[model samples]
Target: MGWFSKDIQTMDDLFVHQLQDIYYAEQQILKALPGMIDKATDPQLKQAFEDHRKQTETHITRLQAVFRMHGAAVKGQDCPAIDGIIEEAEEVAGEVEDKRVLDAALIAAAQAVEHYEMTRYGTLVAWARQLGRPDCAAELEKTLKEEQAADEKLTDIAVSAVNRKAA
Candidate 1:
């Protein structure tokens, strides 16, 4: 459903819709990560992608638990934002001929995904608390922190090695 659709007439509805949105985004990320891992030339970047892929699995499981806890169906809605991000990343990666530049591009792409996830999880955590679902908020907060850390890690990799190598 669209964000402003009549289906979301209440805060609870909005919360659930956001949950479904992020749920779908996470699944998309899971599907995209393997290709990203393959495309990353830097060993650390490759390992980071691999590690985050594992974390993404845990994230999906946690999202399922949150859905159950909220008494919502465990399903995903279409997330065009994530689809666009992944598509753009793929396009940029495909265009880059240098492996070092590709690694930098991959890191940039991963950071964009991480930032998007952080925004969603942060909002979910706030909405869950406002809806008197502290239990759900706590679960989502964990994911938010992880997303933040992943962004920071990507930044570190970019600053310490990848960006310089690309340069």
Candidate 2:
């Protein structure tokens, strides 16, 4: 179900909806990252992708924990945003022929994923607070901070070196 659907009419609803969204997104990321790792020409970029793949796995586990804490079942609904993002990444990766350019594209794509996670986590954190679940929010916040830091690192890779190398 979509976030604005009849099922979600409160902060708790939005929070859980986003939790499932990120959970699904992380699973998709786990499936997608190996290809990205293979496509990356730069060793650091490849390693970064690998590291985030592991981190995303942890994110899924954390989401599951939060669901349990909230007395909700661990499950996921379709997340159009993540699906679109990943599809666009695949398209862009396929379109680029040069290795350096592809690495840059991969970084860009990775950052897109990070940004999506940031928004979800940020909102979820607030929702958790609204629901009077600071413990849940704190756990979610840790992952949020990590995702943001990863985004910044990916931006550095793209701006400081990868995009320039590609160009």
Candidate 3:
């Protein structure tokens, strides 16, 4: 359903919709990470993608648990935002011939994905708390912290080597 669909009349409904949105986004990220890992020229960047892929699995599992806790159906709706981000990443990676520069692009793409996740998780945590689901909030907060750490790691990789080597 659309973000402002009439189906979401209550705060709880809004919370579930957000959950499904992020659920779909995380699945898409899982699918896209292998390509990122293979395309990354830097060992650190490749390993980072590999590590996050494993973490994404855990994130999906946690989301499913939250769904059960909230009594929402364990299913995901379409999330075009993530699709577009992955598509854009693929397009840029295809256009860049230099592997080092491609690594930089990949890091940028990964960070975009991480930032998208961070915003969704951050919102979900707050909404969960407001809806009297502190349990759900606590679960989502774990993923939020992980996403934040992933973004910081990307920035560190970028500044410490990837961006400079690309230049």
lDDT of 2 by residue, 1-167 (tens): 54377888777777787888888888988899999999999888988898898888888899999999998889987888999999999999999999999999899899999899898899889889989999899999999999998898888888888988999
List, residue by residue over 51-135, the lDDT tens digit for candidate 1.
9999999999999999999999999989989999999999999999999999999999999999999999999999999999999
Of the two candidates 2 and 3, the one with more favorable lDDT, higher being better, is 3
Which ranges of candidate 2 are over 4 A from the true structure? 1-3
When 2 and 3 are scored with TM-score, the better candidate is 3
Q: Where in model 1 is the C-alpha error above 4 Å? A: 1-3
56: Cα error in model 3, Å: 0.2
Clashing pairs in 3: none
Can you give the TM-score per candidate against the true fold? 0.98, 0.95, 0.98
lDDT (CA) per prediction: 0.95, 0.89, 0.95
The residue-by-residue lDDT of candidate 3 on 55-131, one tens digit each, is: 99999999999999999999997988999999999999999999999999999999999999999999999999999
